[model samples]
Target: DLLTLDVDHLVVVTHGFTAGLLVAAWIGMPVASAGHVAFPVPSGSITTLREDGFFHNRAVVTVGDVAHLVGVSGS
Candidate 1:
């Protein structure tokens, strides 16, 4: 999956690594990450995860939600 965030003159970009971790957590999967990896992207980046819960439950978690992009146009 891809994640994007728009913040005025700057746009944040990040890979699915973090989001994947969230998914693993939600689905009871084994997750491993390297803490030494540096994030060179902007701080305003947003990542969203959609997953099915136990007993047919549904959940959505937005890390760094992009509410600021509302009504904005272009990329």
Candidate 2:
């Protein structure tokens, strides 16, 4: 599977009406991730692993943060 295509800034976006979001949060890779919704928090700030069970949320540099999901949306 191309899921491990080997790239930087891997993102996975899921519609507000799907379970994809939960799955993504459960398993994040690399070192950055976030959650986005249509209303209130249109986009979640980038979060990075911080100290002891903490992560720093910041701005996302690219939509690639998970647009790839759109391609497999129907599946």
Candidate 3:
């Protein structure tokens, strides 16, 4: 249902491991393939997921980006 949402943008707040699974799912990667892989999602980090107009182009624009946390404590 999430993939068919009509919103122009959406945000999902979840645990690190869950977020990793989401990333893997978005990219069509098998869950079994993630066993040995690591998707580090640091606290206060941002991951950008994109779907372009009409064509339904999907992609992970950025992953675990903490640039906004720069100069902040414990970042």
Best model number under lDDT: 3
Q: Write the per-residue lDDT of candidate 2 for residues 9-64, one digit (tens) a residue.
A: 45544454333343444345222443453122224323222122246333333332
- Winner on lDDT between 1 and 2 is 1
TM-score of each: 0.28, 0.24, 0.81
Rank by lDDT, highest first. Answer: 3, 1, 2
**Model 3, residue 32: what's the lDDT?**
86
For candidate 2, report its TM-score. 0.24
lDDT (10s digit) by residue, model 3, range 21-57 = 8888888788789665667888778999998787977
The whole-model C-alpha lDDT of candidate 2 against the native structure comes to: 0.36
Off by over 4 Å in 1: 1-16, 32-71
User: What is residue 10's positional error in candidate 3, in angstroms?
Assistant: 0.3
lDDT of 1 by residue, 1-75 (tens): 222332222333446455445444544454453333422322455655453334735343555566777677742
Worst 10 residues of 3 by lDDT: 34-43
Candidate 1 to truth, TM? 0.28
